[model samples]
Target: MTSKNEITVTGGRLYYEVRGDGPLLLAMGSPMGADAFAPLADALADRFTVVTHDPRGISRSALDDPREDSTPRLRAEDVVAILDDLGAETADVFGSSGGAMTTLALAARHPGRIRTVVAHEPPTLNLLPDAVDRHAEVDEIVKTFETDGLEAAWRMFLSTSGYQEDEAGPPPSDSPEQDLEDGRRFFVHELRETTRYIPDLDALRDGPFRVVVGLGADSGGLLTRRTCAALADELGVPVVEFPGDHGGFIWDPEGFAKLLGDILMTENVRIPLARV
Candidate 1:
């Protein structure tokens, strides 16, 4: 059974969904929201109670101020709020892309609330040596959005991120207006903070929770792949290879689910089997 619910957060309401029965596992994304992870959640439902949510100001979640810029710390607090609402002391979390940055923040600030975290291809430019250049590129992308328009900004973003539009295809969107709004939010409010987030290496390295950096086997040239490698190196942990590219979970839900389950079980043996 699947249950959809909403809870009041600091600045707005958070919309989330719960599925299946077992240990708590939160599959989340930043701009991507709960809907993006539905297939993966469904695939893991039999063995885990998967919780997915829309980040504030996105989709079903509503922010009191739409213009409010989202930061990793704020989003991390939101995750803790969700856990508190569910009466879950801790949860295994899977965060993809921008969400991975949020997961890192959660692990750093509230390690007690997480059993394990699988951070897949977080675009943490600050971790890389060429971060200055990359950040400049991001600034240019944002500027492009302000000057040229959405499509031009997106084209630049895709190119800089090493995704070929012809090969990877356009990103999925609900509607043109929604897409435009999301794009604007990402470019103007969320992008810079997310990509430039500096992970607390000491906090994560010494945190009680297990932190696993995941990389896509097919993500050779992608900027996120480099970030994943840098993160793994900093943490002194090997990068766990997943099935496909950055959007692997969306493309191969079954395979992604299986691998994620294995990692959680094998890496978190000390975690009790009882449900949260």
Candidate 2:
């Protein structure tokens, strides 16, 4: 059974969902929210008490001030609040895209809160050699959103991130209004803060929790694949490959859940290619 709830944070209220019945596992995404992970959470419910949430200022989560920009640190703190609310001392976390950056921050800032972290395709542009250029590109994308509009901004974003229109998949929301709200929050308030976040490599390297950087097997030439490789290299851990591209888990939740279970259950196990 799924239970829906909300908790107050410093400057906002976070909406979250809990389901299933075992050790806690958080399936998270920024701007993606709880609904995006419902399929994967359901697939893993038999073995884990999965939790999913809307990050502050996104979807169901509401911020006190709509103008306040979200940073990785703030989002990390929100995760801590969710754990505290759930009465969980620690949880296994799976964070994708911007959410991956939030998990990395959580591991660094709150050491014992995470048992293991699977960071899938974090857009840690700061870790790349061409970071400055990439950040500038992101700035341009934001500017385009503010000027040219959403569709134009998305086209530029997809092209810059190495995803073709077909490969990037469908829009996150079927409703135009919902899409506009989500896109604005991301491009304006969250994008720069997330991509520009510099992970505390020292803390992650020496922290108590295990950190696993995940790359999509079909994510060749993608910006996030490069970022994931950079993170794995820094952490001295192997990059675990998953099925499909960046949105692999969404595309094939059952197959993705199986692989995730394997990684979480065993230590240093070889990741076999999963066919969705």
Candidate 3:
């Protein structure tokens, strides 16, 4: 059973949920929020004490300063705050999309707090060979939101990500205006900082924590998939394929959880962790 709770951190109040019993495992997102990870958390709860939360300034986690930009570094610190509140000295982390970037940053910033991090397709645009063009494209998306609207900007974003409308199945929405508002905040307040983040690879490499970069088996040639592989290469490891595309955990939560458990059981990470 999942239990809900809250904690105040920096400029916001974070709402988080915990379920099951065993080693601590955190499943996270950025603007995607706590609700997005519900199914995945439920699936993994049998093996782990799964925790999920809404990142500050998103959904239930309201920020004191809405205008404060959400940076990867800031989000990473928020994750640490959640851990600190839970009294968990360390946790295995599973971060999807922008959350994956948070996982990397958290591991870099607080090496001893993470046991292993499964980064599922973090779109770190700076790592791409055509980074200049990518940044311009993202800027255009933001501009489209400013001038046209969220739908137009989202269409451009989907198209640029090598996905069409059908692929991005419409989410259940009670209010289109609220959805649009969230999208606007994501693009304006969150996207640029997240995409521009250059990870501290030296820290990740030298730290005691293990980082596992993952992508979906059917992701094929998606931009995020390419970047995922790039990051794995940088970490001197091969990309571990989960069951589906970027949102694989949602598509096949049981399978994803099983794979995640299998990864944690892998011999490479079996050695005792050195305290940071």
Candidate 4:
């Protein structure tokens, strides 16, 4: 079962959806809207109430100013508003990439309203040793996007992200104008803000909620995986390995959902790779 609703947040109306029934779990991503989590959410619906939504300025969610730059702190506030509207005092949060950065912010700022945070491969470049150089590379990618176009910028972004272009080449040619614009908003505007965000490690270490830094089993020691390890080390926790690379939920929904359920059931039980 699924139900949809909207909430008038500070800058815009936030569109959200609810599926299944039980303990509340919010699954989110920065540029990735609710659509991407459908399969995982569905698989978890039987045992957990799953909530997914588009971050403001993308998909059904509407932001008053599309040009407004989004940051992890601001996106954290958005999650709070969504939870308040849904009458959920607290929830387990599963966030990937940019969403993982937002989850860290939520845990840092409002630990009382969160049960646990399962942060999957947040690209917190600030935590990395070569942050300055990495950020410069990202800046160059943004410059290329501004000077050239989406396709050129995308190529640079993929290459920098450690994604290899196969013999078949990039995934389809030519994204529509709207998609290009969204990419502009994300890469040009949001990417730096999200990656550069330094969470209050002291607060997180002593906070009541459990903070689990996750890494994809097949993600390799790329940018995101390295950052995840850094964060877990800082927090004095183990880096939990999941089913697949960064976007694991999409590829192994059943296994992902079961792992999440196990975590919730055992209150911070680490899901082993063998089980997944």
**Maximum-TM-score candidate:** 2
The local distance difference test score of model 4 is 0.84
Q: Candidate 3, 83: how far from true, in Å?
A: 0.7
The prediction achieving the highest lDDT against the true structure is 2
lDDT string for model 4 (33-148, tens) is: 78889899999999989999988777678789888888989889999998998888999999999999999999999999999899998887888889999899889888998899
Q: Could you tally the backbone clashes for each prediction?
A: 0, 0, 0, 0
What TM-score do all the candidates reach, one by one?
0.94, 0.96, 0.94, 0.93
TM-score of model 1 (CA atoms): 0.94
Q: For candidate 3, lDDT tens digit of each residue in 84-147?
A: 9998899999898889989999999999998999888899888889999999999999999899
In the predicted model 1, the residue pairs found to clash are none
Candidate 4, superposed: residue stretches over 4 Å from native: 167-175, 268-270, 273-276
Please, what is the whole-model Cα lDDT of each candidate in the order they appear?
Answer: 0.88, 0.89, 0.83, 0.84
Between candidates 1 and 3, which one is better according to lDDT? 1
User: Where is the poorest 10-residue window by lDDT in model 2?
Assistant: 267-276
Give residue 49's error in model 3 in angstroms: 0.3
Ranking by lDDT: 2, 1, 4, 3
Put down candidate 1 lDDT per residue, 26-59, tens digits, no spaces. Answer: 9998878888899999999998999999987887
* Of 1 and 4, the candidate ranking higher by TM-score: 1
What is the lDDT, from 0 to 100, of the residue 101 in candidate 4? Answer: 92
Give per-model CA RMSD.
4.6, 2.2, 4.3, 2.7
